[model samples]
Target: MPISRSFRCSVFIGVSLDGFIARRDGDLHWLTSRGEAAGSDLGYEEFIAGIDAVVMGRGTYEPGRSYDPWPHEGRHCAVLSSTLPPDADPRVTVHRDLGTLLRELEERGTKSVYVDGGQVIRTFLREGLIDELTITTVPVLIGTGLPLFGPTGGDMPLVHLATRVFGAGVVQSSYAVDRTT
Candidate 1:
């Protein structure tokens, strides 16, 4: 049985038309290049504005933590990894147990969290914790790469919320996870 969640988990990410989130080597060059040329955040600020906390797995952390200007500044960030490097950003709280992490966040009154990384998203989704998902599809398809989602053992339905077109051909769709069958 799945446990109940008082806090909300949300995913805001970009994907290629082929359904991959990044290249096979974890490179986001294709995705970043397009966004930079388009000169749009594609509603990222608004989405982050609603997020009180941030959680991601080691794969996302390894790359995201290397940026010069750290993302998710001023928010409590948590990294889900049991094998994280000793020198990981000291600002982030590392957790080996997802359930405990979620429980603590809920107890702290965290209303919403921006859940990132492919594996982390799938884990949360499988646990029936994700409340919403916003996927921005770029025009280019890189053939094969890291997919945005994977099998979760069973079907999880979504309620369509809205879709918007960004600069050029970027299409962003928002969906509410339908918990009520």
Candidate 2:
């Protein structure tokens, strides 16, 4: 049976072996240190290419703001936060509720959405909104840090789709949320 929805929501993120997205101080040095070989992004380029927009939490948006040229340049990016100031970029939108954000995206004819950030992803998963997830796990383990999966109420089953191994023991896996189960 084909899954049907007004818009598809997906997650593409990197996590430590122990399931941490960033270190104690919100540093992604563990991930950034793994320099990419020429013309290699472990399928990230392909993944982002298919996404129509991005939805992230305040935690994720703040760090991205530090980038010389915001990472999500051309994409329609929605920051889910109530405390942050309004976005200066016209492409970026500030939303307080995920439902409203999704509705707005649907109205804008968004077909696929890339849901990011630890807290944002967790919330989407808890609400049974995520359609798919592609998680790349790095080799190193940060004992204390921000975990990717915080208590999400109940199990959300997934069907394995694909897996690829990159240099330095980085493993990327994709899964489709098994909503029927």
Candidate 3:
């Protein structure tokens, strides 16, 4: 079944000033060196308030496993990986494809999905499945790393919804996919 417009897939991530989401090694310490801004959650609390579940790629999941509090405990989490063991984590559901995972979420009456990870976001954008994007740009620039976006097959037109400055020099921008194009 086709996904209802009511069910939205949104990407909320903090990227470097140079567009890198993380270092080649996936180290995010640069993102935490915000000085006085380090303590702030920025708009993460507010943005995640609308998310019903999280969908991420294995690369994201592997590193996220070390997060002290285990971020997606209460929310349903789906990890896209064909090689990840089924019992990798009790809190997560593993799936090999996005369509099947999304259909299951739709059937469960999910309204919002938070799409995380660099590759996963690109995949969603390539598939034209992402409805919105909320990107937070940190003040530092990492010369080389995993970029927030890579080349899709074609140009994607975005309609800017809003832009705001969060604690320090961080900038957050929201955009809606211009499906009319």
Indicate which candidate wins on lDDT.
1
TM-score list, all predictions = 0.94, 0.91, 0.91
- Candidate 1 lDDT tens digits, 1-181: 7676667889999999999999989989899887776668999999999889999998998887778788878898888898986456787888888977887787878888999999999999888888899999989979999888888778888999999988868889999999789
lDDT leaderboard ranking: 1, 3, 2
Alpha carbon RMSD to native, model 2:
2.8
RMSD of 3: 2.1
Q: Candidate 2 on 147-175: residue-level lDDT in tens?
A: 89978787878999999888877888999
Q: In model 3, where do residues sit more than 4 Å from their true spots?
A: 1-6, 35-39
How do the residues 65-125 of candidate 3 rate in per-residue lDDT, one tens digit apiece? 8898998878999998888997989989998887788777887788999999999999888
Give stretches of model 1 more than 4 Å off.
Answer: 85-87
Report clash pairs, candidate 2. Answer: none
How many steric overlaps are in each model, in order? 0, 0, 0
Query: How much does each candidate deviate from the true structure in C-alpha RMSD?
Result: 1.5, 2.8, 2.1
